[model samples]
Target: MSSRSPAPPNAAPNARAVLAANLIRLRAEKGWSQEALAFECGLHRTFVAHVERQARNISLDNLERLALALGVQTYSLLMP
Candidate 1:
């Protein structure tokens, strides 16, 4: 028997949730706050908060900027 929980209705994980989790994890690993990350990525603090909350969709360019600021590959931010 599997120990995993039942899959979500869509079966696939939400991209925004994955991105939010990754961002939170990476930021914690770096000992940075949302404002610090936003400053590093040249984005507004509210924008970073929105991203973390999955309140809005982000652009490819903004995604790339976030990845660059975090020193991670752009694709990693989208990984499930």
Candidate 2:
């Protein structure tokens, strides 16, 4: 194994909410529209909008892409 402890209970259930809030906040901070962020991350604009709406879950790769485009660590999207 790994040295890190497991995530606390409720972490998994809240990840989508965390990601949605952060994405919206970060996008606004960058003064970017959903389309702009999607273009930067190579995702569809509706996909970005859906993510911000917490309407769907995405793969780790997409999460990383969004974080990179937002100039943040991958974990940042999953954290509160």
Candidate 3:
């Protein structure tokens, strides 16, 4: 029998969750607080928190800023 579990209706897709999850991971990997990332990205710290929580949709420009601050390509944030 298969042990696979059914997907949740509200769960983020693998691709999207990976993107959001990576944002959090990369920040931690760099030993940065959300406030630090916000400062480096020229954004408000609450905005960083909103992004990490997937509560806010970011524009490409903001994504680029975050990528630059994280020392990664913008696409890296979308990795699965």
lDDT of each: 0.93, 0.89, 0.84
lDDT of 3 by residue, 1-80 (tens): 43546569996565445767988999999999999999999999998888887667788999899999999999989876
**TM-score: the better of candidates 2 and 3:** 2
Clashing pairs in 2: none
lDDT of 2 by residue, 1-80 (tens): 54546678865656767889999999999999999999999999999999888787799999999999999999978877
Model 2, runs deviating above 4 Å:
1-13
Strongest candidate by TM-score:
1
Best by lDDT: 1
Error of 1 at 78 (Å): 0.6
The best-first sequence of candidates by TM-score reads 1, 2, 3
When sorted by lDDT, best at the front, the candidate numbers are 1, 2, 3
TM-score of candidate 3 versus the correct structure, residues matched by position: 0.79
Error of 3 at 54 (Å): 0.7
lDDT of the structure predicted as candidate 1 = 0.93
Model 1: which residue pairs collide? Answer: none
Clashes of each: 0, 0, 0
Error of 3 at 31 (Å): 0.6
